[model samples]
Target chain A: MKIIRSVAEMQKETLMHKENKRSIGFAPTMGYFHKGHLQLIEEAKKENDIVAVSIFVNPLQFGENEDFGRYPRDEKRDIQLAESYGVDLLFIPTVEEMYPTKPQLNMVMVDRVDVLCGKSRPGHFDGVVTVLAKLFHIVQPNRAYFGLKDAQQIAVVDVLIQQYNFPIELIRVPTAREDNGLAMSSRNVYLTEQERAEAPAIIHALQEAKSLMENEERHPAVIVEKVRALLQQHTSAKIDYVELLSYPELKTIEQINQQVIVAVAVQFEKARLIDNIIYHP
Target chain B: MKIIRSVAEMQKETLMHKENKRSIGFAPTMGYFHKGHLQLIEEAKKENDIVAVSIFVNPLQFGENEDFGRYPRDEKRDIQLAESYGVDLLFIPTVEEMYPTKPQLNMVMVDRVDVLCGKSRPGHFDGVVTVLAKLFHIVQPNRAYFGLKDAQQIAVVDVLIQQYNFPIELIRVPTAREDNGLAMSSRNVYLTEQERAEAPAIIHALQEAKSLMENEERHPAVIVEKVRALLQQHTSAKIDYVELLSYPELKTIEQINQQVIVAVAVQFEKARLIDNIIYHP
Candidate 1:
């Protein structure tokens, strides 16, 4: 794999591929590669003539004291694995390179950022959309892969593409999970020994909620409350939020008749775990 | 020439050309085509295999009490002229078609908007960037054209292109003018007959300032003051502003040594006029 450290060269490379009529697929990450990252790369490789991956731990996306500095990195392994996965291009820009200039005066705050993980982390989706906007220009991808691991992020990306009319397709890759059903994430390394033992409970809670949803229990509040109780019972963590809202649109619904996302976040000692199940009720 | 009123079809049309390795040049306007609009279209046609023009009287770019409601249109003549000029595709989306959904919550406020015409019209450039962002996505042109008549707008477009990493060249077409040197603008239709006769004084004032700079005038304040006095002496319109700033950056300069823009705006009874000349001093 060819590793690029400059934005201009990356844009030039992508433009060359574009001129050659190659469909490029892009997967953007924050470096510490895991099974989820591999899955996204695989998805890209399956569909496009060229696959590009970006590892940018954008400071704009991290809220105050939200581990922007302490975000873990496994660069050597990541580079090797990228080659093994057949990534055509890898972009690893320094923080200074990514943000050479000071940020814009007024921020791009999203409209549907009032719920889910977005509720506690204000401006987080805005930051995500902003960086993606920049990266999309550089990569010039025909399709970009984003995991359903952070469903809110996927929804925000949808809005970004629609509102900006970015002529790029957003592919939603399914969450890569462990044997125990825990969602795969680089931040899993932040879990302490005991916290790691209890981490799988997040997915387990969501699975139970999904079962309830599948069984035709239609009260959103009741399902959310049950999920919260299950999380509290299965793990020693503070419940951040348990929400059931309309999928993609992400609005509160009085009755669960359409598609909905039942999501939950739990704050462990070191890591905050989030998981969700989207289904038609 | 094909005229696309639907955003989806326009996007597909552009994408087809993009995939076929045909370069597209784009000119975005608000209909009522004139010499300036023709100049931009001509520039686009000169360089690309495909040329696309959009006529959207973007409501977002108009401030409250602005002329959005009365923005002139000559749809039949505009369409005929577009075809006569050999435009490959012309997109004239209605307000409802262009804006199917409500706008995003938070606005994109630009920096360097506190001077010149931007000072009087707040959020004007923000609206321009917003609409342009959407249009750029749909058109997906290799190069986009804009007139240097609104120098501040060009500066804002430069920032938008840079900040968002839009992979499109901005072609700054020169301002097409009337025989007496009044800048060609659709808003000129609103000018009374006498006002039209006096409008050339704005350019005369700027020309006098340019002469001062060419003769080694270093102080922007002095040149600006002289231009304001000339405009006041020659035109019946109220002088909105006469200022000199760094080129493209649009910042106040200590002394005019590098590239700079000497810009002015005048408020007639029914129309506001803007003009500028950018050159190395």
Candidate 2:
């Protein structure tokens, strides 16, 4: 596997691949490889002539008070994991390489960011779209892989691709989960022993909400209250939010007749965990 | 020459060019072919294996009171002129084709805007960069051409390319002008015969400012005052603005020790005309 560190070099490599008519599949990620990230790479490896993975912890996506400085990174392990998955190229750009100077233009989200995690974390989606735009231009991937664990992010990417007309196919892999039904995440490392024990309740609450929706609980307000009560009764974690909205569009839905997302965020002693399930009624 | 009217078709055509290893040079313009637009096409024809021209009168760049509805367009003449220049592909997408839905994200200018024409036209640069971003992604030109007639635009494009790390190179063509020294523009058609005759004074003021700077006048205020006085005396036009600043950066400079831009705008009875000259000291 070839390890690339510079944006210019990666672009040149991708251009050569294009000239040779090779299909490139890309997986962009922050470091500290987890099962969820590996699932995305596996999907890419199966579909393309070359699979390229970028492991850059984008600083632009982190707010001033967010965990940017303490974001977990294990370069050696990540490189090994990616290589083991038969990734053809591994790009690990430094913060300086990704952003030599502050951008003079901002890519601001105009929609699909008013509920769920977006409401609690302002400017987070903007930071995400900006870095992703840069990555998409640099990689020029024929198709890019993103896990559905970040459902809102996938929705935002859909809008970006459609609006800008980027010649890329977005491939979404289903969320990878632990044996206990907790969604796999790199942030899982931040959890203490006690917090880790309580994290699975976030997913449990989502599953219960889905079951309730399946059992003819159509009102979003009722579903949200039941999910909140389940989290309160079962786990020591403080409820951040429990929201039900239209999938992808994230618009308010009065009744569950179509696809909707039931998402929850909970604050443990040392970690904030999030989980969601897309329901069709 | 092949004419593309759909964004999907244009993107596919560009993708085929990329796979074939052909270098594409792009010229983006509003319709109504002028000497300036032709000059840009001519330069593209010389350097690239394939020259592509897009004639889009982008509404995003026009203000509420501006002439967006009345923007000049002559498709038959434009197609003929582009074909004569050996343009391999001509992309003419409708506003609906370009923006099927209103953009859910906005690319906003953070700098290089607050001066010159940007001072009077708020959100104009935002609209410009937004459309350009979409065009660049769809066309995927190896190198894109822009005339330096709009100097601040070139500056904004410079930032956009650098910040996004677009793989395309930017080639700037010098401004094309009429014999009497008025910069050739599609809007030149809006001027009455008498107004057209006096419009050359905009360029004349720029030249006078250049000469003054060359003759050791370093203070921006003194040079601007002299240029304003010259325009007032030489033509029956309303002075919109006369300003001097650092080239590309568009920042105020105390002394003329480096490259600078002297730009002016004048409003006639029916048309608004602008011109500028870059000076090195």
Candidate 3:
């Protein structure tokens, strides 16, 4: 595996591969490598001649009060894990390298992005979209991998691709999870022992809601209330949002007549955790 | 010269040229091919192994009262003119073909974008950026060409390229002008016989300001007053804005020490025209 740092070098390498008629698959992440990230790389390896992964802790996605400063970083562990998965290129760009100018460009402006996680952390989606846009242009992948864990992000990115007509096929892998159904997230390391014990409640609530929907209990309001009650069992748990939205659009639906997604976000004593489940009725 | 309508076809053709390790230069414009548009293509052909031009009359850049509905378009004339310059590929995508969806994505959310033309035409820059983003992706040119006539647009696009870290170099071609110094624009067709007669005043004012700056006039207010006085000579012209700003940032500068841009917008009987001159002191 090649460890590339400069955007110009990466572009040159990718263009060579393109000249040889090789399809490059890209996996972008804020590297604290896990099974979920490896799964994305594995999938990319199967579909393309070369795989590229970017690991930059995007500061734009975190608000002033959020964990931008405290976000974890481990280059050694990440490099070993990525090479093990047969990554062709591992991009590690500094903030200055990626953004020479203070990125005054708001490239990821989308409609309805202001809802869901956007409502709580304003400009978070903008940051994600901006970084993703930069990565997309840098890598010029035939297909890009994004985990369904950030379900709202996938929706916003979908619009970004369609609106900008980026020549990329966005392959959304299913949400990777832990043994107890807690979605795999880098922030999961922040959970204290007690908070970790209660973290499963968030996933449990999602499972219960999906089960209820599958069994013909479809009132979105009732499901939201029940999920809120379940999370209330944890004393330190603070609900950010508990929504049962139409799949992909993230809009509210009274009943699940078509594809639907049940998603949740909560702030515990340790860190914020988000997870989701999609179902068809 | 090849005329292509489908993005897939163009991409395939471009890929073949890429396999030869040929550099691509692109020029994106709205149709009604004038000498200015032809000059860009001619310059691109000299610099690149492949020169691609996309003519799209983006509806997103048009205001409610703007001339989007009546904008001049002539594909036959455009193709004939492009052929004269030995163009590689001419991309003329239909509106339905360009926008398969309503484009739920808004690309122009840049700070200070709303100051000049952005303020006059709400969401105009958003559309411009959105369409340009699409074109950038589809054409995937090594160096993209933009004219200095749309000075504000060039600044915005420069930010777009920088902010997104798009792997393409931007070349700002000097503004092509008429013998009378009127900046070439497709919208010049909207000028009536009387409006066309008085149109040279706009350029005259810019020239007067340029002369003042050349003679070391440093005060912005004085320069603006001189330009405004020159503009007052045209009985049919209604001045919209006249200001001296720092280049790219568009911030008002009290004194010109470095590069500065003098810009003006005027409404004639049936059309609004914008022109600018960049001066370095």
Candidate 4:
């Protein structure tokens, strides 16, 4: 696999692929590869002639108080993991390389960002969209793969693609999870042994909410309260929020008649974990 | 020349061009074509295998009380003029087509928009960047052309291109002018005959400032004051602003020892006109 560090070199490689009429499938990620990122790369490899993976722990996406400085990065392991998944190109750009100049304009999120993690992490999606915009332009991929672990991110990308008319197709892979049903995340590494043990409770709460919805319980408020109670009772996790929102649009729904996402965020002793289940009712 | 009205069709056409390894040059404009737009098209045609021009009078760029409703549009004339300039594709998408959903997120301009026309017309550059982002994605131009008349716009576009890492090269075409030196603008149609006659004074003021700089005038404030005095005395135009700024960066430079732009804006009885002269010292 070819590894590129500069934007110009990466763009040139993509342009050559375009000229050669080869389809490129891109999976953009922050390093410290987990099962989730590998799955995305594997899916991209299956669909395109070239599967390119970018490992950029975007600083713009992190809040001032967030764990940007301590965000897990393992470039050697990440490169090996990506290569194992048959990634054709590995783009490992430094922060300085990615942002040569301080960004003057922002790709501000106007909608689909008021609920869920967005409420707690303001300007996070904006940073995601901004970096993705830059990467999409550089990669010029035929299709870009994003994991459904970040369903709100997928929704934001949908708006960006529609709003800006970016030519690339967005392919959403299902969320990768641990055997215990906890969604795999880079932040999972931050969890202590005790926090890791409690992390699955977040997913358990989401599953319980899904089961309630499956049992024809229609009231959103009731479902949310039950999930919140379950998290509060079973785990030492402090509930950040347990929200029932319209899928993708993230608008409030009085009754769960259509597709909905039951998302929960909980603060453990050492880490915050998030999990959600999308349901059709 | 192929005329496309739908975003899907335009994107497909551009994709075909990419697959065929053809370079595309794009000129994005608001309809009523003037010499300036034609000059942009002409420059675009010279640079690439395909020259595409998009006519979109973006509503996002206009203020609530601005002339969005009365913005000049002449599709038939524009089409003919573009065809005459050897434009390969003419993309004329309706406002509804361009913005299928009301944009909830905005490409907010943080820098390069606080002075001159940007101060008077807030959110104007944001709108321009938003629509251009859409157009640039849809058209996928190798090189995009813009007139130097709106120097601030070029500065903003520069930031957008640099920040977003768009693959397209930005070509700044020299400002097209009338016989008497008035920078050609579609808004000139709004000017009365007398207003039209006096519009040349805006350019004259810029030239006067340039000459003063050329004659070893070092103070930005002094050059600005002289230009403002000239516009106030010689023309009936109401002086909007006559300021000097560092080129491209548009920052305030106390001393004229480097590349600078002397820009001016004036309000006539029925229209507002803007012009600038870039000087290297």
Question: TM-score: which is higher, 1 or 2?
Answer: 2
Candidate 3 per-residue C-alpha lDDT over B124-233 given as tens digits, one digit per residue, 9 for 90 to 100: 87777778888887887889998888888888888788778787788888888899878888888889988887888888889989999889889999999988888887
TM-score of chain A of 3: 0.96
Q: Which residue runs does candidate 3 get wrong by more than 4 Å? A: A112-115, A229-236, B7-16, B109-116
Evaluate chain B of model 3: give its TM-score.
Answer: 0.96
- 2 against 4, candidate with superior DockQ: 2
Identify the runs in model 4 with alpha carbons over 4 angstroms from their true place.
Answer: none
Name the DockQ score for candidate 1: 0.62
Whichever of 2 and 4 has more lDDT, that candidate is 4
Looking at model 4, residue B16 earns an lDDT score of: 95
Report residue A163 deviation for candidate 3 (angstroms): 1.8
For candidate 4, lDDT tens digit of each residue in B1-281? 99999999999999899789899999988879988988888788777999999988889899998889998888898888888888899999998999888776789999988998899999999999999999999999999999999899999999999999999899999999999998989899899988887778788888888888889999999989988988888789888888898888888987988899999998887788889999998
Enumerate the candidates' DockQ scores in order: 0.62, 0.87, 0.63, 0.86
Q: Which tens-of-lDDT digit does each residue in A116-204 have in candidate 2?
A: 77788888889889988999888889999998888999999999888989999999899999998888988888888877777787888
DockQ of 3: 0.63
Error at B266, model 4, angstroms: 0.5
lDDT of 1 by residue, B1-281 (tens): 99999999999999889889899999999899999999999899899999999989999989998989988989999999999999999999988887778865344755768898789888888888888888998999899999999888888887778877788999999999999999999999989999998999999988999999999999998999999898988889998888899987788998999999999989999999999888796
Best by DockQ: 2
> Comparing 2 and 3 by lDDT, which wins?
2
TM-score of chain B of each: 0.97, 0.98, 0.96, 0.98
Off by over 4 Å in 1: A105-107, B105-107
B267, model 4: CA deviation in Å? 0.5
Off by over 4 Å in 2: none
Worst 10 residues of 4 chain B by lDDT: B194-203
Measured on C-alpha atoms, candidate 3 has an lDDT of: 0.85
